[model samples]
Target: MRMVFRWFGEGNDQVPLQHIKQIPGVEGIVWALHDIPAGEPWPTDRIKEVKQQADQFGFHIDVVESVNIHEDIKLGLPTRDKYIKHYITTIKRLAEVGVKVVCYNFMPVFDWTRTELFEKLGDGSTALFFDNEKIKDIDPMELVEKISSNTSVTMPGWEPERLKSLAKLFEQYEHVTEENLWSNLQYFLEKVIPVAEQHDVKLAIHPDDPPWSVFGLPRIMKNRDDVERLLNLVSNPYNGLTMCSGAFGADPKNNVPDMVNEFIDRIHFAHIRNVKNKGNKSFIETSHRASDGSVDICDVVKAYHENGFTGYARPDHGRHIWDEKCRPGYGLYDRALGIMYLWGIWDSLERSKKVEA
Candidate 1:
């Protein structure tokens, strides 16, 4: 596995590139042009600017966390073709700069949702939490304000501009169902995947954050069968998945290691983090250690090793530790710690293989 760190560019992030480079096994940054709005083609100069900054720190910007798909694309609106053209252009530019994988999602309205950003954990370190009961009761607008209120850096799924049209977005999806979402996603893949293949870049769709429906929004990519169906929708290597342990693990039914072994070839990137599942469709982010969370992170790592996975992977959402105030889930200390945990697993697997041989 090639480990990368998600650096949200200079000024926008508290953790700098130098700090990321100091992490032992991290060789690259998973990045994007955050200031650029979704559906707009990213400028070549801007992409190069990020590349130059990572170069200065001696790190490769090989994976992009997202080139966010517009709601028009997800809703299958008439204007989707224009946004798709812009997306295709962006893909070509990213590939020109040696980006091997582009991690994007097709979830409508919100990219991911949670009732609370800093739910207090037993250990005093806080984590991103989801309360099933509370989510059912709370208004999504209030939740949006809660998530986007304190930070200058844009949260991944809760883009400020998109949330502004919450009422309209919700109304747009009123008639849409799970099947509609799947068809729309397939439409998007058909248009974008060929361009991705031409550019030698794989489009890795991140699974729905909780791997279930929220606020009555239809979520299709929530299980192994969903992932399999998606891969077969386009039937191309460039059309793939960004298999996230924390997202899929929320479901409890998803065996992440087994999925990794099954879908190894289609996995272009991975978000290896852990979550402690609470009963009845609720979970909270936990330390990346296998014992702390529901997902068997060691087995996940070992599966990757056995499969000879050389694809890019990163420590996903982490706890807000050491009083290091930053983005809710994208803090430095815990993620750095998570990386060490992952490295420990990978190293042990390598040694075990040698011993067995």
Candidate 2:
């Protein structure tokens, strides 16, 4: 497995590219143009600016965490065609910049939701948290305020403009069901996957954050079966999965290592992190160490090694350690630690192979 780090960009992130390059096995950055709104063409000049910056620091800008999908596309609105065309244009530009995989999601309004940004753990470090009972009782708008209150850094899914119309978006999805979401996602894949194939870039869809419905919003990409169905919907190698462990692990039923083994060939990107489930559909992020969390991260890594996975892998969400004032889940200290932990596993596997030979 090839390791990469997630960098938000020059001024937008607290962790700089130099720090990322210092991590032992990290060879690239999983990034995107966050300032640009969804459905807009990613300007070539903007892409070049990022490339130039990464080049200065000696890191590849090949895999993007996301090119955010517009609500119009997910809702299947009349204006979706225009947005999709713009999306196609963006893909073409990304290909020009040597991007190999473009990760995007088809979730309606909110891309991911959490009740608390910093739920303190036993070690005094904090992590992103989701309380199921509280989520059911609280209003999404209130939760939005709680999450976005820290304006120091930009949250991926909860953009200010989108959250402004939380009620309206919810109302729009009144009639939309799980089947509707699946159909809309299929529509999106049909149009874009061909372009992706032509450009030699893979279109990877990130699974829903919690792998379940939230605030009555229909979430289709929730489990392995859902991923299987999605892959078959387009039935092309270009159409792939991001294979996020934290997201899929929230559902106890999802065996991440098994999913990795089954979908190994089609997975182009991976977000490997650990979360400790609290039972009854609740979970909290934890250290990337396998024993600390619900997911068997060791088995997940071994499965990738056994499958000969050479795709990009990055440590997903990490605890806020050392009083690091950074993005909620994307902090430097713990994530850097997570990288070393992963490297330990990879190094061990390589040695064992050498001994056998």
For candidate 2, give the lDDT of residue 309: 98
Candidate 1 residue pairs in backbone clash? none
Alpha-carbon RMSD, candidate 1: 0.9
| Model 1, span 1-357: residue lDDT tens | 899999898888999888888899999999998878889999999999999999998889889989999999999999999999999999999988999999999888888888888888989999989999899889988888888776667787777778889999999999999999899889999999998998899999999988999999999989999999999999999999999999999999999999999999999999999999998888899999999999999999989999999999999999998899899899999999999998988888889889999
State in Å the error of residue 74, model 1.
0.8
Q: Which ten residues in a row have the lowest lDDT in candidate 2?
A: 144-153
lDDT of 2 by residue, 1-357 (tens): 889999999899999998888889889999999988878899999999999999998889899878998898889999999999999999999999899999999888888989889999999999999999999999888888888786578888887877788889999999999998888888988999999999999989999998888988999999988999999999999999999999999999999999999999999999999999999898999999999999999999999999999999999999999999999999899999999999899989999999999
How high is the lDDT of residue 52 in model 2? 97
Instruction: List runs of model 2 lying over 4 Å from the truth.
Output: none
